[model samples]
Target: MSGSWAGGRFGERGECLLAPNPGIMTLDGTNTWVLREPGSSTAVVVDPGPVEDGHLERLDEETGDVGLVLLTHHHLDHSEVAATFAARKGCAVRALDPAHCVGADPLADDEVLSVGGLSLRVVATPGHTADSVSFLLPTERVLLSGDMVLGRGTTVVAHPDGRLGPYFDSIERMRSLATAGEVATIWPAHGPVHDDAGAVLDHYLAHRRDRLAQVAAAVERLRDEGATPTPRAVVEVVYADVDEILWGAAELSVRAQLEYLAERAS
Candidate 1:
């Protein structure tokens, strides 16, 4: 998981077409997954990704006939070309958010989508963003975790739209799936794929709890020092080891943590 995650086929029915866009935030770029059952004539595309013309063209050429396009969320990096790509393939785009859907109704939680003999169960995992969703391939015991979980690092709990309470709940839900043996592998939308789903879910939960505790302690320490326990101030203390360039993302999580703490107190 430390090295670069070059896109390639995985599991029995999934292939990762890594988008060209990559950065600190995107890691190895948005993973545009092509899911098709063996011997199927058409495929299903997930998170069509950015507006890269070459990427879209490659998807069109490589995938042949795409039956449908699904979005994990409405983030520009993930869904910027969903509608356009779907239209080109003569398919409909489905997402948790209606605004992002094209020629198709919004996806419902627990909805079972069957295409090209592949079965994908929609799991609403709103945390990284309110519209975030994960697709569960029961036959493969794989979860296509959008931005809710990443292959390399922790996901940012984008505040305002992303709530800490919901984020925690979502992680817990995923953890339960892992514990129940329903999810054995995580085919995330970013970075590499994880074979140990339970371990990863546990790590994510523990990391969040550790960060929350650290944030709480930092707030108390700042208050005792007669300094306002602002999000940035708490972030400086809690995320001291993190790079300054990622402070903006840390601040968003800090804000969400603060809000979660406030709500719990009330």
Candidate 2:
């Protein structure tokens, strides 16, 4: 909250603004983005962050006239305040899910949504959440990656709603965009902005592959040591370097890893 709201220009047709909401679960706060059409005053707001009063007020103050409020997913941290904020701005809340969506317009994969002369191409990026999506601003070659890719660390594939194979596939999809030079920058839902879209995508892909390998190794080690292959035991051995506080989250990852291994073996 101390730093001034940072805004930057993306190519000729788009502008990106970041509102950092630092705290638990939010990492360096959620990155609330405002993408506007060049030379236009109206803008589209993405992932308004948590429903904190201050954050909402700051969003209103920063984005003078919002043409739309779009949620990348239905997570509370991202869309909890969508209804209130959309009502305040007299804009409709567009999302993939109806439960969290303020209006009836459900976002479709490959859908082109426009506001104020700027358009965002929706890319279905499930596995972070079933409803998770990434927005591609083709004109600027910038992607609003929601929780699919984080500026730092890997995103949790919150299971039940998230899965490993699909998550890997989603990363590959983003990687294709970067490799094709269709995306140059990543405006993630959390943490700082990333300019090296291709490199970031590569890193995310590598990280997940390495993690799967590590999980497999950990399971093998447990077998070698005659340790029970329970989820808790695997988490303890595999995530020993991770903070104890995050073990719960690690356990979820371990579960996903186990499922992956099980499926592969079958």
Candidate 3:
């Protein structure tokens, strides 16, 4: 809330319209991206954010003649207005989850979508959620990372639906893109844009490693004291510095970590 994440135009084909929802979890708000190729009449819109009257009105005005609507994930914050907005624009909504799509097939891994002279490569990055995915604009060298990568801090690996193992694989896949110079900038769904994709991805990986180590140590210490390592208990020890308001989110991540540890042990 201290920092400004007022979304704006970036690269050659993308413009961000920041939503009104701001909170502890949603850094500033969801980034509703309007992507159009230069001189193209039709464009593609991504993650049409929450159902706010003003935000939707602004989006309707900014995004003239939308060719298609793309979703980073099925999170309500990002997809609440996707169908409605797509309906208004007379376009189809597409996501990794078919349930989220309207009048379009579910997005396939490594699928290349060409619309309005712009090309986007769909990269399956299901870690934050089972249906999570990222879009790679090879021409712009930009990655539209949904909740998988945030502009401010590390993203949470929600338990049950979100697994640490898949999250690790997703991060490594993104890192490979950055390291290969295929992706230079990260246009995250929340918070501000990142210039150096490689640096940010490295930080995300390192932070997750540190947290995993801390969780392991906390679990071991608890077991030594003849205590059961519950998710809340693990969170209390590992995320002692984090705000209490975020304990719920922290606990979700702890559950994922515990499951990951169990899997590794097996």
Candidate 4:
């Protein structure tokens, strides 16, 4: 069902449940997902979302017994409630980063975790964060993509914690999985569920490439105009069409791109 606090389910094999946590940094809101095997009693919880009490209560109501709490990344919005939720359910919270994990085990790539006979394969998808990962549910051909891919708009590279090259590689990796028919839908951390996994992944990859090209063009434009080719000036030109609110974020991406370009030039 769709509502202000919750979203509908998708696919016959598993549900694409959502717990919306709308806020400033969250854009619309963070999505806490519940994925269960068809006709199973236990379910796997992905990204427990923020520490909102109401959300935790809703989670309790939605999932009676959680088998595991799997985190895609360590972003606050996605991982803030993991510890609490895991404690409440007496389940383990698994993540790639040990720091973000409470008492649960650290997740590893290629590991297959089973909950109520349903298995999930972990895929390391860093770049959104050094510890980012995606879960592949083969039975449903569904991928639970965390911050690596969003439902609404593009995700920030999150510089310092996130990088451009690895981000591109992660997208391509997801695309390859989709191309292989390993993924039919994407259950992202934010926004609605996506049915066209392959096309969406392709679009995400192409968009990043296009943005890099735009950054290059912006650098060229500034040089032609005789403006200083510093990161700040480059940001002004490359992100001219972007809102001031997002320019700061754009600048980070620009800086990352500039660094990549500089390294390549050398």
Candidate 1, residue 126: CA error in Å?
Answer: 0.8
Global local distance difference test of model 2:
0.81
Candidate 2 weakest ten by summed lDDT: 1-10
Worst 10 residues of 1 by lDDT: 51-60
Candidate number that wins on TM-score, 1 or 4: 1
Q: What is the C-alpha lDDT of each candidate?
A: 0.93, 0.81, 0.92, 0.81
Task: Identify the runs in model 3 with alpha carbons over 4 angstroms from their true place.
Answer: none
lDDT of 4 by residue, 185-261 (tens): 99888877788999889888888888888888888888898887887788787677777788777777777777777
Report the C-alpha lDDT of model 2 over 1-266, residue by residue, as the tens digit. 12333446556654444545565456767777788888888889888877665888877777889889899998888887788888889899888887777765788999999788998899999878788999999988988899998767778878767788888888899989988989988888876668899888888889878878988888888889988788788888878898898888777777887887899999
Q: Candidate 1 regions off by >4 Å?
A: none
TM-score of 4: 0.91
Best by TM-score: 1
lDDT of 3 by residue, 1-266 (tens): 13787988897798999999988889998999889999999999999999875888889988889999999988899999888889899999999999999999999999999998999999999889989999999999999999999999889998889999999999999999999989999999999999999999999999999999999999999999999989998888888998999999988888998999999999
TM-score of every model? 0.98, 0.91, 0.98, 0.91
Angstrom error at residue 90, model 4 = 0.7
